[model samples]
Target: MKNDVFLKKFRQTIARYDLLEIPPAAGLGRGDKILVAVSGGPDSVALLYALLEIKDEFNLRLYVAHLNHKLRGRESDQDQKFVKNLASKLNLKFFSKSIDVKKEARKKKLSLEEAARLVRYRYLENLADRIKAQKIAMGHHADDQAETFLMRLLRGAGGSGLSGIPPKRGKIVRPLIEIKKEEIEKFLKQKGLSYRTDSSNLLPNYFRNKIRLLLLPQIKKNFNPKIVDVLNRASNIISLQQQYVEKNCEEILRLVCKSKRKNKIVLDLKRFIHYDISLKREMIRLCVKELVGDRFASLTTSSTELSFDSIERTLSLIQKEKSGRKVKLIGNTWAEVSGENLAIYSRKEKQYNYPISFPGKKNLRSLGMNIKSKIVSRPSLPQKIKSKGEEVAFLDWEKLKGQFRLRSRRPKDKFKPLGMQGTKSIADFLIDMKVPRYERDEVMLLTTKGKIAWILGHRIGDEFKVTDKTKKVLRIELIQKQK
Candidate 1:
């Protein structure tokens, strides 16, 4: 009878939020073990108590993770103690990590707001992974969802951003995403349960707090009292559309970038030129990220929008002119038109190719190199030029820029090094290579661009090196790990 009452009340609440029609939990499989992130706030306390109340129904094994971002000093410590004591009362396993949030923020070069959230999520994610928990639940209620949606919307976030807080995101789930913050407070009051409030939440300093206390109250006063619910509905509708677009993006990636052998993603410009603007922008940006990760392309995401400017332009020319064209792109990769093959460099990697032809599945750190190759039957190349300082890959001869340029150091730089071999002093030969001593080795030799045009003590075999009669292509990969 107690379980029946709990279910009836829960169903009533779900219906009030119009979440009664929410899809079954069969997809997420909440499973038995659940990790909950508790901040001792009213919402979290309600979430914790509700989970405990319904544990038997869900067959749940719950663990609590908390982050002590020591920004409030003693007050923060008190919050931590308050949470620990409650966990003790509840007989729940409690995990806490004391971190200098300010220091971390500085070290990560992030704003305090961004860094705190980042560290908190990192700790929670690690806890979930370590415990092998399937869902990491949080206490974000509908009010929080509204704030996030408005914030992202103001920031010019597209549909993905407007989707707001999802009920489930990877291992992280907000089980109470449909619950209002005040209702949680009411639930706690009815049960005579007390919760600790982070005083900072009331301050106008943080954008979220300002939204919660100032903007939201103003909206309720001027417009409607149910603004949060209205925004929540808006976010849900946006989420549906966002999911469709995301699904299409995944398909686009699979189609255009499937054959890329290495971490680099090569775009087939022909196929890509056909996509509409929205998908084209996303596909192009994803291609850049897939090949080079986040560090490459564009200054700021907001200002730069998509990092596909160069690639998009190249595609435009290909579509507009129906001819061969080439453009240099961020992250030391190139988008090129050669014969019938329109390609985005799948091998945008830049690693030291000190010694080429290292065997497969290697950790050849000693060679100052990290590259890979699949030894298939030797495909005929347009030309065979060694890794001259200005050459990294065995590319088609026609692609070569026609002039061999090498970069390396020389004091009074004089050398009759190979090909231009003669008793030219280090000064004269370096002058010939037009490379400065400081940048001679680390100049990252390329065709005036930072591509792997050469590796010092190697060959400057060629650039845009493919020839007219070329038949096959050799794929080379480079890796420069940031993590």
Candidate 2:
């Protein structure tokens, strides 16, 4: 008789969750490739061996991907070599990359741990795309989930944040999510497998490390010995409740949301104010997430730090019928009440006046854009050129006086909008355009001789509009800065 109880348990877990089976809604099949992230640690080593035991049963192809965050000098290299040898022993194809995580941290203005995580995931996604992998496998386990829950709890997280790390998200799957770290170590020891350990993990330099090395053990020693299990159970219960709430919230959002765009979301106040206060708060959180994109979802370590204060402030603005009232939010986002609609949008940074070099490009640092100006003869212009967007504007070269200045709207600024009878205040123009009051200050204005020529992304001044009598045209293009 075979003695493989651990392997049997692993298989049971996989089957219980249908980890290997392709969901009916998914576009791929069961035989597609899966990418496994191996960090040469005990948890990942156990995960790799367990998956290898069942690879043939599922008819799945396995590829190992490792990222060496070059923070440990020689030790990091040894870890990479260890993982490579392990992959070779298993006869699995391996892909590896090394990145200077400290340098990345400085460049991105993030902590070393955050930079490493971001770089590691980006590399995994790119490799998966290159190899046509259906899913990416991670080694996070129950102990990690417990630690995450405590961290979020200490930070006063709501239901969604208290749910802990998700076992499955998009194309990423955690095969060992329900397994304990001790169980992983037991499996590795039983199989006589060798793995490398990162010394930095022993240090309390990062918040998660502090929780793992200090707080968790103290909690277990002073309180329940099975605190990890208790936390994991609570996470499961909360996750189920959150899922139900989120489903209902999505339906309510669909009914009340007026519009959803790349960086902005609008919801009807009439329909939104009728929901219960609890659902109202959830609705505001979801709208903020939609406006700022999913990346902002993880802006805080707890992953739900979109503080109650911000949401309450926004709700108050909506209740007061203050059309132009707004409240700033985390992750450079804001919520404003505008004419029976709640608008959530990203805030643009303030910009100062900068003189534009004729026939040259000038960087708009605050807006993440560049202005390119060029003068060309009227005869050289395309005859049937369609407007690309409001970002690009053409003006009569002769109508311009001295060098143009790019700046924000002044208090007494006035502009002659194209096809308009007379000049109008910039404030009134923005109000008519429905631009949120808080964002109006960041709108770029191209002025020449103290006269408004173009409202960057909206309209061109009537005096600068190109006409048949124009001898030459000055073309100005606003190009977004690529990351």
Candidate 3:
């Protein structure tokens, strides 16, 4: 009777988790090498134990990586030791580290949570690369997922927020996602296993801990009794459907973002106005993620997901001004609308329009034309390239690099004009030439070894002005249809 009852409970838990292993073709498979990150907490410990139980069935090679954030001093070390002992007893390969997470947080000038998470993921990614592991398993469960969904919803999130934590992501998988906190505790009790409890979880200061301890419990008691289960079910359904939405989003994105080299994306407002709200939001989020790097920064809280910092803003800017307009985005990134397409570009890409390192032979493709160079006789350059008169330049022999850099002019740029005696600031020179407001900003400078040698389509720098001493000069030319 007891055996039957245990089996029934186990089966129910598996059903809830969606962890019923199918054939190796569908499921994670037996003996799949998985790296489990354990924190010695109840959830992670439970996951470790469960994986151990199924180790033989799965033909699994398991590795345990435990991080000691060292926030709690002795207690943190104790947790690390516990995980080490547990891994040792189970004969699992264990890697442990006591990281000075607080110190790193201070060094990076980031919040404690942000720094620790970044450091942890970086370490895990590095380990994954070294081990060539397909999956890195974490112990986030249903309760945590439910709380995350609720928190993101409160924080002005759309359906993407509702999607919550995934069971499997690239090289990262959460196998215990279907298990709830209560169910996990019950399983540990049934197995006569004890797990370390982090006192921080009881504290109401951390937003997540507070949700787990106070908000969710209150919701369960007064609002929804099976809230966790309902959320898990909703998340599962959402996850499956989101995959379809993601595929649609990818297709829409390909049409929307036309050029990778130009770093721009556009939602044909006419076409964008058609999709249903869910798919529309997903498309917007995915495009922003690809162009901008994170899904969190995709859109605003609205169903349209049209954030002020997104393609919507780029479109607005272009509508107001058909000329060059810049939108400074998150970090070192910016976006602008050029012609019909909304272009997303980082500040670095825009500011460093000049080549950073012109190493070796390069086929120049900027300046609305293509120009190729080879070490040959001075006569190799056609008369059109040689005597384009003021438009052509002969660079100094000593300054030429097999490899050089090119970039846009900076405020600090000052050079002595070839015929002039004094150093002239580029700022003054552009004013002297009466370079138009719009065109002036678009002017690019060719740089070699950190100094501007020439401004493309305009004038060569004073130092690079061909001198009598400069006999071996790099011939500059413009490819033209010869008359």
Candidate 4:
């Protein structure tokens, strides 16, 4: 009867989270392959058998994977061997790798546990990508979730962290997340299945182990006997609350946002400061996430590294009256306060310089765009005299002379903007236009004979503006090339 309940709950957990269901994005589909992360422990062993029971129903092609941290000498090798044998016995494909967790920990300046987790997930993701697997399944169970909640709670984590281990994130799924460790061990016992144990788990050296070994049992005996269920329930509540908050944060982001690029995100300082303090922090977190999304291997890992102290430090830096100050953020990113904008970016942008030819499209490699220039007769052009959009500009062709070159803004650059009688410093002009300081470096200028003709994607010089006397019109178009 208990064995039946275990299997029933296992399937229910998967269904509840849509673990095996087809996702909206290019993810799991019917009869798709899944990479199962099996460490040969009781939790993993039970997970493998549970998934096997539903293999035909889901049409899943299961592949077992194991990562040996090599922290336990012969024991690590034995764990790998056991997983390989288990996969062979089940007639499933197996993948395994060995890494020095201690060495990696020292090199990456992370704890042994953190290093092991990072390296293991990277290996699993790479293997899944190589084999074209649609999903990667982990063996994290309810007990692990409860422990994670306690750990993060102790560290003063917010709602995002308090949500605990997610059932599914991207291609990584934890079908066993709703199952408990004791239930897993009992399930394996009922099936007469044997599994390997990592001896390090018995030692109370690691904080997680200490929490699992020392703290949980006492709380269960002296306090709530169903602490795991309590924590799990709390995590679900927090996750739901966080989802709502994220939607509001996204809406607020659009309002305060100045600009966003691949590696940089700029927010309007004037607008950002007016919002409630909590909203400001959430907006900063969103900016960090946008900039660091591609930098980290997984979303959960990035969330864990986004510490409260780091967020507080960023808030402190941006709130100060001083500009040009920067603070380091997680995932190799940084936050800076530059004039009227707060910039969160990874690295400095490079300068761009390229030649433009008439009646031809020149691809600006650094700008990731193509600038097409052509001469059209006034009769052939639209009746409108001024530019319709920043991307498309029209100038008096006869007034311009010599070849045009597009380059990054220079320190001494000045331009007489259209409708302005006198020339103004490009730097002051951009500042008056409310362009972020960091983004000013990326602004390009189209110059002819050492004079600014137009600021690409922004403005056209007064001298280049088309007039009624202009017979020929120079049409310049900026086209963004697909990545």
Candidate 5:
């Protein structure tokens, strides 16, 4: 690979993905800060040099970041030192961090690779934020993409996993994604650049190593000589298809989604059940992606956390399990069949009990809702007011007895809904109304004299209904607060 060829390919990948542009119209073609993740290996070292060669053309301010996982003891330190020295030689800023990946793996109950990858990305992202970098560049190339595809394929991964490595994900960009590993090494040699080699990569202990050193070679020798190119081509096609699927999934998600919070998503089960199985699986993946605070592309290609079995279990919970049943998911998330809906939540649902003040507004933080209570005289009410939705209720004020409080439902709670004869259990009423079980705790109740006055946003109790004989009415309104 000639110097000009390597640079041309690098620029081409950037152009194809629009990598350097932050907002497309930002004219970020020049004077952009970039943080380059360098591991002192051949691929990363080549990437740094390649970017450095074109830095002036793009008017780029490049910074180098390295994480010493400390797995190889002295070798890890040497790797960090090499990266720092390279950055210094290039007259660029350098940042380095050391972490005991084995210790972190044990403490976090994760694999060594998982722990190291997580810590490395966190340090890079934080450093990038601190430096106000517009882009974080990685050295993932064609060979890595093919290996990733094979690994995921063997693990029974779906479309998302089979999509392979992306050229750009969020602020992370891979300029070498289209370049072959062999071409990268040739470029380094042609440029007389030296790079450190990790001994661990030669060992077949890790799954990736097994694929790179063992499986891939065997396939190339016995199967197709150009297996890497074949896999890469397939991944590119699948990636395009996956992007289209993701777009459609997002549109469908809007229809099925009932409520979306920072760490929770409630889906209407009645609407969800009507979708095809493929759509359902993709929707589940998208929900997990949102709950985990991941960019869609990042989760789709690189994440194996949401396994086929985990998604299947969630689907089973939605289809077969009784309402209120939940299945645990990755990243401290849970999927529960809540009556007429399915809820994916990262945090535990909490119960709220608070005092209600008349003629005042109260914010319910737990429910992300607000309650406004006011007393209105019947004579002052409009003659032909528009019919109110479930959020508004008119109750006879004279019938109210003890102190008023807004709280969640308790066990065996019963209320005589307006226009209904006898009392019905709160649980049964919620079921009959098709309210999700996860939302039951969030349903506010206006209670006085140890009796339910209204199921806020649902129904007003029979005892508190406004009538012709009533002179004053307790008007309560429920408002959903923006998260």
Candidate 6:
């Protein structure tokens, strides 16, 4: 029968992808639950019917989940009622919820499309967790994948984005990913099943809708007649290649990066620079993802989804800039060069400023270091008075005027070095010291009433140096905090 042909192809796809058994190794067995997301559309309705036809063969438990995004008023409500009635007719359990997508969009400062998607997925994830479902199935056919690929391509997305929607992501599975939308409609019509159509989908307000209603049809008519098929095939090939590269990236990430602290990941500059540019881009992307995992998931355009420009800016900081340099990233994240390590971390709200306390320990929270200052007699000082390490500074206590403050370098700042004859601009001093331009702003200055007395981690001011005439000595030591 014509009906039999459609069922046969559906079964073949399910078997090929091993969708019945989530892990494939965990063979389709008894008591297995699958949450089917029914959006009251042709694609989803067809998916539900196909699964129902073969549910007994796999001994599967099927449940329908729907979200009423209150965008179309009465039409949206009707969609929910339709899906509920359909589920009841099949004697299956149905779960549904209503949400004001417009309000959510305004509150989150996101577009209507993005807000709806975020709220929809969050609801499904929670429902799946509550029911302990093994998999959440969605109806995203090959046409959707092609549309997504083209959309991302137009936006200048890289290989990962070009791969289109994945077949499986965590517990979410798309059994219809390889099927065409036309085939789904044909199957629904053959089965005499009626479904609700969302009027919003016909609107050209959204980029995806425009692609689906206008761009795709034009491409098929004017360009390749089988544009969807060609795009889907390309996506499949790119998906496999992306998986391979991502696996290698994970291995390289383990070898080159370490979890330095909460909200921070450090990559070894030495190893990172050796990698090819393609690998470097992926590595940076992975780092950003790791740094902001799940935090921006509700946002439609995730900050983790770095654009080509953002990745290039980050790579410039890593490859070209010197140690102590940093660049800001999306999602309130940033990448910094700390010595031979590159740190990717979330931004902190705390300002990096603290006054130095004499004869006591003052914790510099921003720098993750402690300033220990002690006023002691000259004899008590170390005989060597080793000025080799910048962390330790021996200054004449009497020479210091007013209060000492630790702050970042300011514009046109001038400081007289301990050995230099005259005062030199901080900019010139950093250049002379071979400090990277990007890192110059981060250089800390120990100031006495706004006069630079010491360039922390670098040189000390000549005016503040302890001479033979000095009776009292100020021993300032910079101690790194223990992890």
Per-residue lDDT of 60-147 in model 2, one digit per residue for the tens? 7899999999999999999999999989988999999999999998987778767787788788878998998988889989999998
Error of 2 at 125 (Å): 2.0
Candidate 6 Cα lDDT to native: 0.81
Worst 10 residues of 5 by lDDT: 295-304
TM-score of 4: 0.75
> Which residue pairs collide in model 4, if any?
none
Candidate 2 collision pairs: none
Q: How much is the lDDT of residue 363 in candidate 5?
A: 77
RMSD for each model, in Å, please?
A: 10.1, 7.2, 6.9, 6.4, 5.9, 8.1
Which scores greater on lDDT, model 3 or model 4?
4
Q: How many steric clashes between backbone atoms does each model show?
A: 36, 0, 9, 0, 0, 0
In candidate 3 the C-alpha lDDT for residue 311 amounts to 41
| Candidate 4 per-residue lDDT over residues 298-341, each given as its tens digit | 43443347777887887787767568677777756778888778
How far off is residue 12 in model 6, in Å?
2.9
- Deviation from native of the Cα of residue 466 in model 3, angstroms: 7.6
Tell me model 3's lDDT, rounded to 2 decimals: 0.64
List the global CA lDDT of all models: 0.61, 0.81, 0.64, 0.83, 0.83, 0.81
lDDT of 1 by residue, 1-483 (tens): 333443355545435543312334534434358788888888888878877876765557789888999999998998899899999999999999999999997886766776787678778878888988867778888898899887767666766557777776556666577778777777787788988888888799977788888889999999999999999999999998977887789798777653453333445656766778788666655555555542331122222233335756866766675444556654355555544445555332344333233224434453333555342223443244454333345444334334433233324433334455334554454445644222232433323222333333333324433344555444444553321
How many Å off is the CA of 97 in candidate 3? 2.6
**Evaluation by lDDT, superior candidate among 1 and 3:** 3
**Per-residue accuracy of model 3 over 1-483 as CA lDDT, tens digit each:** 323443354445545545434336423555467788989998888778777766665566789998888888889889999999998998888987767989997886666666667677767767877887656778888888898777766665555557778765566777767667787887778787777888877789876777788888899999999999988788767767777778878887666654453233445544644566555556545654565443333222233233434545654575575445656544334565444444554333356553443223344444334444433344443433343124555665566765466666777887765556788888777777765333455556767766667766667767775455554556564342211
Candidate 6 residue pairs in backbone clash? none
Q: Which regions of candidate 6 are displaced past 4 Å?
A: 22-28, 260-262, 292-304, 322-332, 347-483
For candidate 5, lDDT tens digit of each residue in 1-483? 358888899999988988875333333555678999999999999988888877766777899999999999999999999998998998988988899999998987778887777887778878888999988999999999999999999989888888888887767899999999998998988989999999999999998999999999999999998999999999999989999999999999999998898667988989999999999999988888887874334433233267888889889887785777877666567788876778987754566677776777877776778778889898888754342327888877889967988887887899887777899999888888887555665566778988988887888887777767889887878888755
Better of 2 and 4 by lDDT: 4
